[model samples]
Structures are given as C-alpha cells and as structure tokens.
Target chain A: MKIAVCVKQVPDTWAQKRLDPDDKTLDRESVDGVINELDEYAIEEALQLGEATSGEVVVITMGPDKASETVRKALAMGADSAIHVCDAALHGSDALATSLVLAKVIGDRGFDLAIFGSESTDARMSVIPAMVAERLGQAQLTFAGKVDVEGSTVKIRRIAEHGYDEVTASLPAVISVVEKINEPRYPSFKGIMAAKKKPVERLTLAEVGVPADQVGLAAVASAVESFESAPPRAAGTVVTDEGDGGVKIAEYLSSQKFI
Target chain B: MAEILVLADHSGGEVKKVTLELLTLARSLGEPSAVVVGAGAGSTVDALAEYGARRVYVAEDAELDRHPVAPAAEVLVQLVGPHSPAAVLIASTADGKEIAARLAVRIDSGLITDAVQVDADLTATQSIFGGSVIVKSRVTRGTPVITVRPNSTAPEAAAGPCEREDLSISLSDGASRAVITNRVEEKHDARPELAEAAVVVSGGRGVGGADGFKVIEALADALGGAVGASRAATDAGWYPHQYQVGQTGKTVSPQLYVAAGISGAIQHRAGMQTSKNIVVINKDPEAPIFEVADFGVVGDLFSVVPQLTEEVVKRK
Candidate 1:
C-alpha cells in the first residue's frame, strides 16, 4: 500500500487574503503561509493507513520554493518521502493546469492510492481532485467521511447533500477527504528531526512531462477579466434591549418586506 | 442563436430550484437546452420548459448514477462533441462540479466553478476572498463550462417551445469503476431547503445545547423558512452537521438571514454575507455579527426569538 498525500501551502485561514491588483493573481508573499487546513486530514489518513498496512506514505506538493516547507511538515508527521514540483512557469496556474501536473507526477509513481484535501482555503473551488482523476482516468472517491481498504479495493462513505452513500472502487484511485474524516496529528520533535534527513525530490514542469505551453496564466482556459472589492453592505441599525427589542425587530422585518 | 447546455439537477422526479434558476440565466445567453441524465426526464419536462428551456435531452440510464460521477461526465462529453454549444451551465453542487470537471478535461475546455453571475458573453463574476472581493473571469478555450452558485439568481418563469430528446448511453468500462453500494438519504422535512430558502434562521454556540434549538426552529417555522446553525453549534452536537452554515459546510445566500447568538467568525460570515438582508439577535451588543447585520438587537435569544416568532405569526 503506497499512499501519496498531496498537500498545498496556503495563507493562514484567518488572514486577509488578497489578489494582486496588477496581475489579479493571489498574493502569496503578503501573508504567512501554512499547510492548507484540510490537507492535514489527508496526511493523517495516509499515515494511519501506512502504519496499519506497513506500507510507505509519501507526500507531494506543487508551488514555489516555499512549498517545500509543507512537504517537510508532512514528512515530519510520518510520511516517508516527499516530492516537490516547483517551476517558475507554474505561477498563476488554474485548476486545469494544476491537475495536469499532479496527475502526471502521480501517474508516473503508480501509487496505489492518491489523497487530497476536499479543497484549498484560498480557491475553495473543490475541482482539482476530480480533475486530476479525470486526467489520469482513475476513480475519484471524493468528499469521503470514512475510508476502508482491503485487498486492492477501497471503500468509503461519500458525503452528499441529503446524507451519505457507500462507494467502492478499485486500487490506484484518487480520494479527497472532508475535514471531518480525521483529526491531523502535530509533528513531534523527534519526527521533525528525522524529516530533516528524509529525501525530498524537486522536479520542474518538464521533468513531469508537462510542457511550458500548457501551464501558467497564459495557458489558462479561464482568464481573470476584472476584479474589485465587493460593495460594502448597507448601514445597519443597532439597538440595546429595552423590553421591546423583539417588537422593534418585527417592525423592521415588516418594513423590509421580509415578514 | 447558439445552443447552451444546461444540466438540470433532479431528485424524486422533480427538477431542483437551482436548475430552474440556471435556465433563467441561460435564456439571456442563448437557446436553452436542459439535459436530464437520470430518472427525472419524464417528470421534469414541464418544469424545465416553464423556466425557458427550449429543448430537453434525457439520457435515461439507471446505470449512469448507479456508478459514480464518471459516467455522467462521459454522457456530457458525448453531448458536447456533437452540439458544441456556446457554453455549458451546471449547478455548483459537489456532484455537479465533479462531473463538469471530468467533462472539462475530456473536452479540453476551461471550467469555472461557483460563479455568482455570468454575463451574456460568458464572463463570470465570482465572489472570493471570503466574499470580500469580486473577480470576473472569461473562458479562453474550448466550450466554456461554468457552474453557477445556488440561489444566486431569482428563478423566472417563461414559456418556451418544449422539445424532448432521448440520448443513447455509451459508458466505457473505466468510467463505471466506482460503484455506489448503498445510499442513505436524510428523511425529508417540511421546512424549505436551506440553500434555496428565501429566509433562514440560524442558531449558534449561545444556543447552549441541542434542546436550545427549539426557539430557532420556531422562528424559522413562523417565517416559513429553513433552519441553520453556526459551526460552533454543529461541532458541539447542538445541531445536525448537515444544517451547519459556514465555509466548510453549506453556503447559503438567502434573501433574509437571521443569526441568533452567533458571533460572526470569518468562516460563518463567508457563507451568508452575500445574503440580501441580515438580522442578528444576541445578548452581547459587541458581538461581531452585529457589524454585518441590517438589523441588530442586543437581547437574549431565548426571549428575543420567541417574541419575534409570535409577532411574525400574529401578522400572518
């Protein structure tokens, strides 16, 4: 059971994220970066599965040079090795190009299972995992709240709008886990020290068989046209309770036609 | 006019509200074609035509959904190859995004998800950065695939020449690998669907416990709306996880959103800030939710919610 957990370095979930006005791309350098919140669940799930099956857990990431920090963090949390797909041309890439690179790397490795967080906080698109699965022509078991593995087959409880569905697929599949799947473990000091000695392979787009012509903002299918801050909400009316607060609210609702 | 494919979401032989809303949006772009992939084709025709769908295509295959999303993607891909519609419009649900994603890859098109508004020329406006920033995007390659956020548009009814076509299903072996073994749908309730509800009343940590949600439900029932909860309440088991309204939960942009005892965390605000009207009821006057509310009352939710519910019921 060789498991690959894909992690991304994103700005702190609580930070003020912004897009650069000149280029309309996410301003990654303006804020402190950390491993995407939900990816920790993917890492933890991979580590637990690896431990249970006595298999190897490898971490993978794609971004600027700073992204290796996320890979190292995943390794510190018990992943055995790491791969960082870093290239200058990878900047301003959209989900399509990102999935292509991820699929190329994962396809080359022939891992039994590839895992991802449901979505990145910044983008919040939740399309990359499915896109990667399509690019590889592999089964996508996404939004999994629970996962079970047996004899080259994987089963999961896929969360849906109404409830959940029990889904099963063959091995060498792509899986995206929701946040409720498991709690991620923090790295221990000894584990962090061991990670420093672990192997981290760095590759460029060419090495992954992704041509420069097929990536970045220029190659993107959907191009950002214009952007502005959302219009400020209207002024609000605030009042402290004076025994008739509910009546006042009812009147306000009536006036607004909400009642 | 160029043809535009609109994927209609159906359940229990009825088309979903978001699909009708998508049809309204599509009418302004080009000729609207509704594609029903599963069981609801026979039952959803009138509703689809009522919302301005000029043509309806049904791929009536039980096996399409018996497998996971891949077969649906294959179906859409087959449709796109022949018609080459101006654009593809789909709902931004979890399943819809996955199906659109696979079709985008197979057709070599640019795909945009969760768009708040799409223009006549296929440019889409998206609210991002936790709903603080608005970005407009355009597809530059292949047939554009755009997924519209639910409740982003007001569904309007318009008569159209309703024509129906049944598609031939041909799914490859690889597309049917992931099989759905069992399904457990939540029991249907009388309240309106949260995402589609025009009014939503949500409770938070200050609700105290699961028992405290009664007042919240009372207000929702009085207004003929849906019930929601902040992540704190859901995480604490005070409410069902499905009813949680936040970034990681469900994003709802109702016409009127009432937050009771919820401190406006960034996650909670991101989900419902786009709502047209917001009202907050909490004991603490300084709660952050007051900043975004159109009407804020500083009072205990237990007292405020019941009184408000009574007043609304009386007016009706």
Candidate 2:
C-alpha cells in the first residue's frame, strides 16, 4: 500500500500577519512561514500507517520555491520521499483549481489512500478535501477524530454537532483528520540527516498536465472587490475594584439594558 | 425575479436558527425558495414560510439521511440543472460546506464559505485570517454557491403563503461509498449554546485549573448566558475543547461578552471582537483585553467574578 499526505506552508500562527494594501492578498513576506500546524498530525498518521502496513508514505505540497522547506520537514518526520509542485502560474488559485492540481498529482501516484488536515490554518475553507474527492470520483470522509484501517476498509469516528458518528469507506479514498486524532512526533537528528539524501521530485503546471489557463490569478472564479483593515478598539472606562466594583458593574449592565 | 435556493438545516422536525437567518438573507437578494432534505420538510414549512420563503422544495429520501453529504449534493445538482436559481445559500457548518463544495464541483460554479454578509447585488463580505482582515468578494463564474457563518444576521419573519414543490432525484452509485453506521448524541446540558446565546462569559488560563470554571459557570447562570473558554484554558484541561472560543474553535458574536482573566491574544479576540459590547476583568492592568473592552475592571478574577455574579442575582 502507498499513502499520500498533502501539506501546506502557512504563516506561523503566533506571528502578526498582515494583508497587502493594493491587492488585499496576504502579506506572506512579512511573517515567518511554517508547515500548517495541523498537517504535522496528518504526516504522523501517514507514517504510522506506513509502518503498520510495511508500505511507503509520500508527502506532496504545492507552493512557491520556499515551500521546499515544508516538504523537507515532512521528509524528516519519516516520509519516504517528497513531491513539490512549484509554478508561478499556480499563484492565487482558488480552492477548485488547487484541488484539481492535487487530485491530478495523487491520481498519477496511484495511492491507496490520501490524507489531509481538516482545514488549513490560513484558508480555513474546510472544503478542499471534499472537492478533491469529487474530482477523483472517490469517497471522502472528513473531520475524523479517530481512524482505524482494516484490510480494505477504513472506519472513522466523525465529529458532529452534538456527538460523533461512525463512518466507513473503502480503500483509494480521501480523508481529512482533526487535531484530536493523535500526537505528532518530533524528528530525530538521525532522521533529519537521512532526509537530506531522500529524493525530492519537482513538477510544474505543464509537467503535471494542468492547463495554465485553468489556474492562477486570471483563472480564479472569485474576485476580491475591496478590503479594509479592521478598526482598532477604542479605550473605555476602567474601574479599579474597591470592594464596590461589583455594584458598579451592575449599574453599567442596567444602563446598557442588559438586565 | 430570480429565486434564491436555501438548504434548510433541520434535526428531529425542527429547523436550526441558522436556516432562518439564511432565509432572511436570501430574501434580500431574490425570492427565497427553501430546499428541505430528508423527512422533516412538513414540520419546517411553516417556519420557512414565516421567514419569507416563497417556495419550498421537499426532497424526502431515506438514502440522503443514511449517507454522508454526497446524496444531498446530488439532489442540489439535479435541482440546479433545471431551476438555474440566482444563488444557493447554506449554513457554514462542517457538513454544509462539504455539500456546497461537491455541488459546486458538479455544477462548475464558484463556491464561497464563511461569509459574514451578502449584498443585494450578490457580493459577499468575508472575514479571513481569523477576522483580522475583511474582504468584499463576488463570484465571477457560474451561479454563486455561498455558505454563511452562523450569528452573522438576525432572523426576521415576513409571513407569506408558501408554495411547495416535490423534487425527485436518482442517487448515483458513488453517493453510497461512505456510509454512516452509528451515531451517538452528546449528553444534553441546560446552559444555552455558546453561538446562539445573547450573552457569553468566557474564562482563560488565568482561571488556573478545572475546578476554577465553577465561578465562571455561576456567573453565566446568574446572567442567563453561556460559558466559553479560551484555547489556553481548554488545552490545559480546564474545560472541554468544544467550549473554546478562538480562531480554531467557535466564532461567537453575541450582544454582550464578558472576559474573565483572559489576556486577549489576537486568536482569542478573533472569536469575540465582533460582539456588540465587551467587559473585561483581569488582574493585569495592561492586558490586551482591556483595549477592546467597553468596560474594564482591574482586580483578581477569583474575587471579582463571585461578587459580580452575586450582584447580577440580586438585581434579577
């Protein structure tokens, strides 16, 4: 069995991110980039599955040249090899185009299963996994909090409104796992050194057989017409407690008609 | 006039509040036509009509309820082929987004998720990057398929006599690939839901431990509000992660929000800054939470919270 894990590099969650004033796009240059926090869990799950089945795990990502760092991180975490689809024409692609490119790559690899985080930290669209599955005409199981893979069937505990539901799908399916699935392991020094020698395959839009006109900023189906920075919060009155602060708060609530 | 299709989200014959909110928003763009799936359309028709639904499409199929998402998307795609409505609106729940994505893929339409506002011209306002940036967008391709965030708009009734249309669709073989085998409903709690509550009180790492949530719960009960927690508190095991209010957790825009002992990191603020009024209580005088607070009290939350709850109870 062969496994594919899709990963993305996003701005660090702790960094102060900004948007470009002209195009309203994210100012990626201003912040430090790291592998999306949740993708680490996906990589770990794939590595564990690979070990259990005596198979191989392949990590794939689509981004600019700097994204190689993200692929290297996954390789260091125990993936057998890596694939990076780097092309200027892929910039500003919407979820549909992105899913198409990923599905093409996964189909070419002929994997038994594909894994992804429930959503990226930056986009947070939570729709790409389903879109990719639709493009491939395969089964999609998302928001999996617990996963178990038997001979040819995969069962998952899916999180829902109130509780959870048990969902099952066959092999050659796509699934997205949530953060609660498992704890990710840190890469050892030996693994890091080994990753330096592993194969890293690079592909472009044409190399992957994706038409240039079907992707990129010009091909996007949605356009941002306008944007504005969030307004700063104004300073309000602060009351120091002198054993009567509770009474003052009660008065304020009353004045605001909250009581 | 073009009709706007709304996917009604219902459970046990009762429609969710987000569905009504979507109907209200749909009416602003075009005539609202609700598409009810599964077996509960009869029970939801009156409520859908009350919210300005001019027509209701009832698609009662047991296969839809048994399978996950794909069957429902198939129904929508079949309807879209004939109706060609101006747009489709759905609540931005996990399941709803997946359905919308599949529908968009099948129909070759543009899909937008987590929209906070929609205009008469069909432009949408989205708060991206955890509400730090606001962008106005419009679909440039086929009919727009949008999933709106809950609590973004209030529901208003516009009573009308609704027309009903029964839709019949054939389920494709691929629709049954992923099947749900079992479901477990969580134990019910008496407190109001965090997203629907008008007033919310949240605690953070400053609360210290699991037992420390007692004061926060007492305050919420006294004020008839809901209780929430920062991710830091949930990650520390002080509360359940479901109750966490942050970028990664739930986004709540209530009428009144009270923060106790939270320092208001950007991630935490993203969930609650859209609230109408904010009140903060923290021992740290220079906490970031005070900057966004309408009222601030500098003191120990352990001491301040109990007294505030007592005052609220007394007033009531």
Q: lDDT for every model?
A: 0.90, 0.87
Going through the candidates in order, their DockQ values are: 0.74, 0.66
| Maximum-lDDT candidate | 1
lDDT of 2 by residue, B1-316 (tens): 8999999988756888889999999989999999888877667888999999999988887667777888878888988889999999988888899999999889888888889899999999988776667889999999899999877788999999899888877878677788899988772366766766778999998999999999999999989888999989988889877678877677787889999989999889878887778999998998998988999899888888898899899888
Candidate 2 chain A weakest lDDT stretch, 10 residues: A19-28
Clashes of each: 0, 0
DockQ category of candidate 1: medium
Off by over 4 Å in 1: none
**First chain TM-score for all predictions:** 0.97, 0.94
Q: Which candidate is the best by DockQ?
A: 1
Superposed Cα deviation of residue A211, candidate 1 (Å): 0.9
Give candidate 2 misplaced runs (Cα > 4 Å): A21-23, B187-189, B222-224, B313-316
The Cα error of candidate 2 at residue A248, in Å, is 3.6
